[model samples]
Target: MSSVLLFFQGLEHSPLSVGLRASEWMYPLVNTLHILGIALLVGPILILDWRVLHRRATPPVAALATVLLPVARGGFGLAVVAGSLLFITRPLDYAFNTLFQIKLVCIGLALLNIALLHWSKAWGLAIKDNQFSQSVRLACGLSLVFWLLVLALGRLVGYR
Candidate 1:
């Protein structure tokens, strides 16, 4: 783990990373964009997740999935790009932060959970049966928990 952290510390000192560090405005601007990307990604996602949770009145799960999936993908894309820019600026600190690692793990799990939900091949059956399955609800519940934790850990990176 020490060696791995050293590697990230090395990355933080790279020419590009140094340039970002050297520029006062660049880092903050990029971070702001990264946060904006998160908003783009998480906001619509909660709505779809709400459908599964029975929190809000919306179209059926299958129909809502069709609409919100694209928006979530766009948000994920933006967050990835902006996050990359923000990450290199302080790789070492993030590499060692316990919460940061947890955040990363949660992100991986969140993505995996969504992929599994999509690949489950149950949506069509549930739709045809005119019922919502508990599996879908479970995935949405997990996604909600994981993403909320991710948000908290991300904020903790600054304080911890």
Candidate 2:
């Protein structure tokens, strides 16, 4: 058999592939869950970042972070699970899709942005003082942009 067919055949025998194929509605269900998770994850992050940028009625940064971080983490977990299932349904296609690759890269950048915010002493001091500095503002803007890119790229996966 051709390599592509062999790869797909291998995927078909995997547990995730079997699960994805076992139910006609499974892929749709997983896709829905993935969307829900993305919404949950992005919504609070956007709101918090906007507050940081606009400086209007901003909550204490620590308080906002505390409130949103857990929710975002939960959503991340759900998204990962559902996304993995969705990917397993057509692993070869997903792996080769430009949109999917872009989405992955965007996700990595977003995660890196978050890590930088967490690790930066300036960010820590700003949060402690309830002030959003220029650096923090830039991070917030980049986070929003990258995440939106991720969302758009994720949607484009099906088309591409």
lDDT of each: 0.81, 0.86
Scored by lDDT, the top model is 2
User: Candidate 1 on 31-119: residue-level lDDT in tens?
Assistant: 88888888878877888777767844347766776777888889889888888887888887777678888989999999999888777
Looking at model 1, which ten-residue stretch has the lowest summed lDDT? Answer: 123-132
lDDT of 2 by residue, 1-160 (tens): 7898788768867987888778889878898999999988998888788778887655787888889988988888899888888888888888778889889999999999999998999788977888777999999999999989988888888777
Candidate 2 at residue 3, lDDT? 92
lDDT of 2: 0.86
Task: Estimate the Cα RMSD of every predicted model relative to the unseen true structure.
Answer: 2.2, 2.3
Candidate 1 residue-wise lDDT at 157: 84
Q: TM-score for model 1?
A: 0.88
Per-model TM-score versus the true fold = 0.88, 0.89
